[model samples]
Target: MLFLKPPGVYAPQDDTSLLTTALHEEPLAPGARVLDLCTGTGALALAAARRGARVTAVDTSRLAVLTCRLNARLAGARVRALRGDLLGAVPDERFDLVLSNPPYVPSPHPQLPRRGRARAWEAGRDGRALLDRICSEVADRLRPGGVVLIVQSAFSGVAPTLDALVRTGLDAQVADRRYVPFGPRLRERAAWLRTQGLVAAGVEKEELVVIRGEAAL
Candidate 1:
């Protein structure tokens, strides 16, 4: 499907593809409700819509919301695109499937970026600023027998994510993993990552993992 990403909006990348692949593996019932958090360019949302799911795409960035809406239009897909903080925009709604490729790159800053391109990829120091919130709050927004698929780098503590979901009464596991070379941001922070012991000496690649959590039946 055709997608247009503006300057500050994130383009569909490896994480997005990984989550989309996992989405296809799900046994979605007819007219399943799907929520795409951090829906940059609306790629995943459109994918779900193509499968006849009612899709909602959410992002905090106005540019991202606009990009997603435009992409959905271009794909001839029906998607409700909204601008709000993660999970905040859909408090009154529940979904059968929730997909997110949230910011998981460990950054030197202790706080998330308020604006700019970095906002698309910069999480807190350990990259869990947004992730932790998702794990803790997403369960409440999931319908019974629903599922959530989230993609993050191994550097951001995959075990914690699994444990978090489990604590929320969901059965969770790693649905997919891909070893990818460090991108420009991660490469630039290689030294810091090494200092923090997140990567082994001379390591230039990281594993991207898609974590799937299923709500109780």
Candidate 2:
């Protein structure tokens, strides 16, 4: 499930840097309520925090949370990092902006990516299980007009993810997108990649979907 020797820290990968940059580009308020899901090493959370947002970052790994706090302090970001899986740690919190780069690998077998956090890189066979859960639950924790920004693989079939959002009944659209390279492959994973037209797409510069529909009524 772990790929790097320094498993607890995020030393900057291509995708990671991309996500961080996107956060820097968001037009959030100086004191925006921000929620960062599966916050790895708190990179995005830290970025948002530095922008003056009251950021709350969540991660299931104890090491990850600690590392996030460390990263935040190193970056001088005022972020609240926690050790909890998904939304477990913050059952009663709502935010103006929610961000996550969840696990979307579609494999029945339980295996971790050899590059990033293992828990942050694996999903069900369709790779939509966690993404589905997050999409559906996000509305419950977002204020009206709030935004949910996420990064998932094109290989997971972007359409299905959008369907999940529609099924959740939230208005959403792809705001920013870019091609990202597939790091490695698991059994049949490449086939799934091809099915999504990602194998030839060469990882596909994923995206940051912005979701904020007319009040989740």
Candidate 3:
């Protein structure tokens, strides 16, 4: 699971591990087309490629895209790493499976960061800025009977995510859950989150959920 993570590129952590586990648990057919959105270090992308899936990873950060490509080359895995906003690089392409570990951490900032490492994790007040958009658009990219696995913090509201996917005519539900200690980012915002009622006082852990959405045949 170790990969080259440049200074500015996001290093895979707990959430990444959780999503990677889910990726392994899912049934993946050989040669299945897979798309990894907000691919970060492309850890999940590499995993899929190892499973014989045709993987394409997308990230807004140039560092991340380069890191993914180099990692894939070193691992001898074939992966197409592209630099672009989520789904923007392959608007006309459809996939048999899609994976995303997007930003779902609520932030005091109202707007998403246009530059820097913050772009990998800051997703506005509700943390749904990117999540909502992905839910709305991912269904379109999914081939019939395709599935998408998305990992996010429960603080971002799981119900809304399921509802959003259902509205898009996909069956969505929580596929996996884990409780982990807050990372530095969440720990720094603990007090603010408490004030916003997103976190309780003295609570040092957050729940991460992997939501699965499946398109109908």
Q: Identify the superior model by TM-score, candidate 1 or candidate 2.
A: 1
Instruction: TM-score each candidate.
Output: 0.98, 0.80, 0.98
Q: TM-score of the candidate numbered 3?
A: 0.98
lDDT of candidate model 2 versus the reference: 0.69
* Candidate 3 regions with alpha-carbon error over 4 angstroms: none
Candidate 2, which ten residues in sequence have the lowest lDDT sum? 206-215
Candidate 2 local lDDT, 1-217, one digit each (tens) = 2222246453455555666666666678779999989887777787788788999999777777887887777666688988876887899888888888777776655454444455666776677767877877887888877777777766566776666666766787665566554455343366665675445534343433333332363
lDDT (C-alpha) at residue 78 in model 1: 96
Query: Residue 88 lDDT in model 1?
Result: 93
**Structural RMSD, model 2:** 4.7
lDDT of 3 by residue, 1-217 (tens): 4469888788888989999999999888889999999998889999999999999999999999999999999899999999988988898999999999998999999999999999989999999999999999999999999999999999999999999999999999899999999999999999999999999889999999999999999
Q: Write the per-residue lDDT of candidate 1 for residues 20-78, one digit (tens) a residue.
A: 89999998887999999999888999999999999999999999999988888898889
TM-score (C-alpha, index-matched) for candidate 2 = 0.80
Cα RMSDs of all predictions?
0.9, 4.7, 1.0
> On a 0 to 100 scale, what is the lDDT of residue 111 in model 3?
91
Query: Distance from true position, residue 202, model 2, in Å?
Result: 8.8
Model 2 misplaced regions, further than 4 Å: 1-5, 8-11, 108-117, 185-217
